[model samples]
Target: MRVQPLIAVEDIERSRRWYQRLFDCVGVHGAGDYEQLMMPGDDTFFLQLHLWEVHGHPNLEPAFVRPGHGVLLWFEVEEFDEAVTRARDMDAWIVQEPHVNARANHLECWLHDPDGYTVVLASPFGDVE
Candidate 1:
């Protein structure tokens, strides 16, 4: 049983670059305006970025152009600072600074992808100060 995330986007190329840099992911498969990314880790799931315009999925039309609602995706890391630094270096929009969640036992930072989906950069508790 594997769970994968299918994210609708306006531009596949741009989203590809962002995911590649942020998650160190590589293109596993692609066709036209859609691509599947395989990040370094267990191979149970892959990230799918699809161009909404090409697919003609009505729900994705306006939202892809101006995103709203949804939890989006969360990319967990073992090192919070390194992840945050890489995101910053790429000029990715940081929605929130790193903070500890004592209840959740993690340190996390939030950012919005090109399409405005929230991506969390998190590490287990005590991993970062």
Candidate 2:
């Protein structure tokens, strides 16, 4: 089974570019009120971007813009370093610099997407060392 997480953004195209660059993914669903992004060649669950209040999804309204109140959109990236660099190049809001998580024994960087969602890019266990 695959898990696909969707977020409501202000601009579908803008968020699409930001995410595609950071994750090195593609916008398989193209630009619309909603979009789905997938890894390079894989086509399974990855992520989804929906325009705010477009489809009337529960809890996806302008009042709910501050999404990172408690949750995190976590992802494990194989090329952790490159991903971090890509994020920096895009001037993405970095909440925490890249660092090794002793507990997880890997690397991780915390950042926020265009819509203010707390996004995490983590390396595979033991991949850092």
Candidate 3:
């Protein structure tokens, strides 16, 4: 079975551009405010970007409510350091620095995308050592 991530974005266009540059993703399919990104991987991995409005959520007003927060997504990279460096250079919000998570057996880091969704970058221990 394959797993796909459905990410909520405040603005689909802005998020699309950000992810496109960050992950080198190409458009696989899309219509209007919804799109699927073809990430570089052997499996049928896809990143789905959808607007909050599509979910029947009211348009965010400055005083209405704050956007949600938490770990919204995770990604595995072959080169952990290179990926972290690229993300840092792009001014991505570095929520967590890259380090080996001994318990998890992975080298990982965390960053937030334009919409405040946590994006994790990790590499398996086997790949790192």
Quantify all predictions' global Cα lDDT against the true fold.
Answer: 0.80, 0.87, 0.73
In order of TM-score, best first, we have 2, 1, 3
The superposed Cα distance between candidate 3 and the true structure at residue 17, in angstroms, equals 1.7
Per-residue lDDT of 1-129 in model 2, one digit per residue for the tens? 788888878899999999988988888877689899988769584888888787678877775336657779999998899999999999999999999998888999999998788999999988755
Question: How close is every model to the real structure, measured as TM-score?
Answer: 0.84, 0.92, 0.78
Q: Of the pair 1 and 3, which is ahead by lDDT?
A: 1
| Candidate 1 lDDT over residue span 1-129, tens digit each | 667778888788899999888877787776768888886675644788888866577666655345636575877787678888889999999988888877777898899999888998889756644
Best by TM-score: 2
lDDT for 125 (candidate 2): 85
Return whichever of 2 and 3 wins on lDDT. Answer: 2
Considering lDDT, where higher is better, how would the candidates rank from best to worst? Answer: 2, 1, 3
Per-model clash counts, in order, read 0, 0, 0
Cα displacement (Å) at residue 28, model 1? 1.2
Q: Which stretches of candidate 1 lie above 4 Å from their native place?
A: 41-45, 56-58, 125-129
Worst 10 residues of 1 by lDDT: 61-70
